[model samples]
Target chain A: MMSELHINLSESLKSKPASDALGFGKYFSDHMFIMDYSSEDGWHDARIIPYGPISLDPSAMVLHYGQEVFEGMKAYRTPLGEIAMFRPDMNLKRLNNSCERISIPQVDTEFVLEAIAQLVRIDQEWIPDGEENALYIRPFIIATEAALGVRASKQYMLMVILSPVGAYYPEGIHPVSIYVEEQYVRAVRGGTGEAKTSGNYASGIKAQEIAKTKGFSQVLWLDGKQHKYIEEVGSMNVFFKVNGEILTPALTGSILQGVTRDSVITLLREWGYTVVERVISIEELFEASRQGLLEEAFGTGTAAVISPIGSLSWGDKNTEISGGVTGELSQRLYDSITGIQRGKLADPFNWVYTVK
Target chain B: MMSELHINLSESLKSKPASDALGFGKYFSDHMFIMDYSSEDGWHDARIIPYGPISLDPSAMVLHYGQEVFEGMKAYRTPLGEIAMFRPDMNLKRLNNSCERISIPQVDTEFVLEAIAQLVRIDQEWIPDGEENALYIRPFIIATEAALGVRASKQYMLMVILSPVGAYYPEGIHPVSIYVEEQYVRAVRGGTGEAKTSGNYASGIKAQEIAKTKGFSQVLWLDGKQHKYIEEVGSMNVFFKVNGEILTPALTGSILQGVTRDSVITLLREWGYTVVERVISIEELFEASRQGLLEEAFGTGTAAVISPIGSLSWGDKNTEISGGVTGELSQRLYDSITGIQRGKLADPFNWVYTVK
Candidate 1:
């Protein structure tokens, strides 16, 4: 746990991308944080090195078996030109939970946090200077053991990379259309739906692509057990304001516990808005929309803090939500979170952690 | 597809392991088969190269999204010193089917077959001579693009590796005890369960590990939607001889279409055994077992052609089948399949394909 951290600067650093050209996950910083783990060494040799390729045996377990987990956070540049992060502790804890679910070894959260902060400070220039533009940090652990077996790996590698990303919505807070997926499922209640493992993501992409083809931005997955209960929309936790009460699917071990979703719930509760976490079936939601009770719908995730849902198409039935625009609640939640992240608003919740 | 294949022999070929010490997936051949695929060039540069590591960027799609598929087959040494493969064509076609499900580009089946055959012919000496010993061939494809978007990857790599493996049952062909998994669901209808994708395997492994802790050799999974219908046993297709009639769970999109299971059904049908595929619920199975109609049970997969199920433990209920010994049908199926694989019996269905 007390491994000495090493930094090896790149001989020739690459130039950062122009702020306007940055989209998401495309341009990376010069340096990355990495660590290795084995049964004997137990997570040793923490280092920050020049970003480059990682060679693995073709028979590595991560490639053959999807034994990998990742976390996404961002470093925001405040109005005073200082770097800040939002509830990184929550992300780190969730990462460990994901590792436990998939049998990956748990890492020291404090040490990993320190390493991440150090890495971000080293490449602070990559933090793009634009509203909503932040240096997106991706921390991932992969099973690096060189074996073809379908079991847990004896060796693992943790690497954290930084990318300068544009706003999730390029123009502004526009609404996203969603397709209710009935054919394919993301996860069941007793599956890796709650875990941030690669398998869950990989298995769910086909449905997302199908939605894209159907002119929708994301796929709203139903429960695997019955294809009735609303599980999630793409990689985000879904929410709806039916009869003026915010309702989201409960954490039933089949959906990712989104940090932003929790924050939204907290803020809504504080604002005297009724919030409920219970199983909401697709039938009930559509019927509510038909009766004009479904006031507003949205999705919450770390990547896109609040993605307002404009429409949901299930089979031949299509319903418009929030008048195909960002709802008032979606707007407020986004503003408050982004404001605190950029040091524009009062940090009463103490969610922001300044690195510089 | 007409690209000339490159051959790079190892500087010093590794020594072969002793027959008895050849564990599963432990010792690999000196060379491996590989091919590259990109959006511009669809699956080109087929080659046989020295077994080595594959360097990937930390942001490779396969690391984040489990966009990977694999196939398992074995090469057997005939009594006349000729090497043979069991239904390589079917395995290749199934690999394409899995690729289709995972959004991976399909490779030319004949070209890949030729590549695999060439590699096996080159490493023919590694094929063990023991009755149950053969070279286990693993063909896998993985997403190689270095991006973090949750869409299909533009770049992919396909590699094939061979390992000299001893018998799955090192001691003898014995019956296995299984724990019926009702807590964790593996797959549901309209999921990747039918495809040989890494996510399906990775998500299902936690249950397998739990069963291992309970001293069961494997996990018999029920359907994901309802924890009632019998689905599969570990990585194999399950079958029960109920009242002298062979029955297996139909391919209802959640159960893997095991290659060995199909062969077993074909052989049984040819031998005048009434083989039926339908939905079999756990309650029905238990009732049949109680009434002694479930005389024998077994699992079928490429690794263990026929793994007889001696006992099934579900919750507090445990029942023993076939007096805890290999059933007559199970023993005959194993003997018939292995005999044909080892070139000891006459090839009636023409499954044995000798490498040129």
Candidate 2:
């Protein structure tokens, strides 16, 4: 079902030279990819048109009911100046998982990958050639049907938009301070937490804001039930190092199975590190930190390959992780991931997908 | 601060016959009220424009990140043929509370109410004169800024759109079957469960669909922690009658404080019924049903004022309530609330806010 995509290239490309100087998701390329889905027509009318406004009915299900899911990846510029996407298949799988959870129709992963590859290929010039810069790719599906009823939509729109992003950390990879949110939760068991959907992110905004106000970069959300177990951060999967062993939250239904998080875990195991996935209780983590067993903490996501945690503030206690700097393990994980992405390291798992 | 609103009404209106109707959130009136807010301009560019497409940047926060909140109310036609809105001030206050939680800028409640009134007054003819028919009002705010970073949006849009709706149960108030969703939780403590936001509703779609497929009208969500306590039904606040006492989930931070839910509580208390807002454990409810202490169960929302629960299926256990018919308390509460809204009974509580 490889239909010819209607390509409406912009009359002229507008260059954003300073985009590399800005942070991620602050700038866009000239064009975007869009495809419409209806129960009657399936997925049809694919197009790559000028990046502009999308007119949606005010009562569109996405607006009122939040029937939407999205994927986040990047188009990386290698040292050879060739543009590629890292593990797009994973994003496609996650996107479908999110769609299934949200009751949206499952899109063919092959179709989505082909569309995305073509999109990045056409917008190749937008891929920033820098250590920390790339073209951030956001593919989202929204319910466009103009009905306010609390039911699945019959019509939907799947779109892929490119943003020319600078470094995720404009000031370089400095360890961040994270606030332990004891009140607000990001996801619960049997919620859309495992899916790359918008609801989970939306729910975390308040807690994230509170974290920011308290002088933290992001929130460390606990499980919704007892608020005692560790879950994840706002947009990333969390990992902690206890006694030189790496532990992350298991896929217990409430945490997003991030592509970066998965890749990091694989690379860690490949490097002979003890990577464990299980329910990490907050009480255990706090005790471990106090006992000097908790060595490091970091979060993994597409935007930030691995963001090191400098310190954690939960309740009234603020504890520094590995002397409030990036630990050796955190640095190694970041280096391996970025090195592979930047073509500095050998691609052992064949994770990089060239945009051609 | 009342800035002059730019009321740009649509030149033409699309009129639909009174008999042609959908349940809710389907057909829209000709015009809509919109206002734009930016960090620079504050809140400006308020207008009543033709109901049409809203152009948004591909990287708009709401599209990808789900930084959105909304409120639902209705405009009714009194016997004097005057269009009136229910307690809109309550909606406005709740909207602001949601905005504050999500870090979105707050709109003036008076401004919002006046704008809603203006829109409803302009679309007064669209309000169906039949019983239980009115113009459903959906006021929503979305983060319109075209940035993908995990931060609050600097720009926002506050808009009110009206849709002409028929009775939710056009075939009369038939008892609805509800499935006990022990696996999928709608919200958790410390989440946006209480806010009238898009993410909270989006997370419930899958659960609702599963219930629907299982021959139920809605899914009764459990508390995210233990999945033991009954929280709410899809989109509506839930209620239970056990041993002649009306019981509901307290404001435990995971359930929406529905206006209809609050109104029902008030009406029940004034009607000399024992009402309690506390955690209602699912096990207790099931045990009560077994012991013949559970008398009735229902859901309350603006769309479905009060829908009787015929039966509940949790895991392998199936329980029927009130012989699969409307219970006496359900009938009395429904009659009192609907009677007040439909101008059939005395509203001593002054719950109705008459539109000027």
Q: After superposition, how far is residue A354 of candidate 1 from its true place, in Å?
A: 2.2
lDDT (tens digit, per residue) of candidate 2 on A1-356: 55667888899888676745767787788888999999999988988898888988888889877889998898888878777688999999989989999989998889878988888888888887677887889999999998888788999999999888776767667799999888877888788888888778877777888778778998888888788889897688999999989999999988888899989999989888999999998889989999999999999988888899999998998889989889998889888988887777889999988776
User: What interface-residue Cα RMSD does candidate 2 give after superposition?
Assistant: 1.1
Give all candidate RMSDs, comma-separated.
1.3, 1.7
Per-residue lDDT value at A220 in model 2: 89
Interface RMSD of each: 1.1, 1.1
Output the number of the DockQ-best candidate.
2
Candidate 1 C-alpha lDDT tens digits along A1-356: 43599999989989888999788788889999999999999999999999999889887888887888999999988888788999999999999999998888999999999999999999998889888688999999998887766688899999999999987767656898899999898888777889998888888878888788879999999998888999998899989998989999999999999989888898899899999999999999999999999989988888888889999999999999988888888899899888887789988888888885
Of the candidates shown, which would achieve the greatest TM-score relative to the real structure? 1
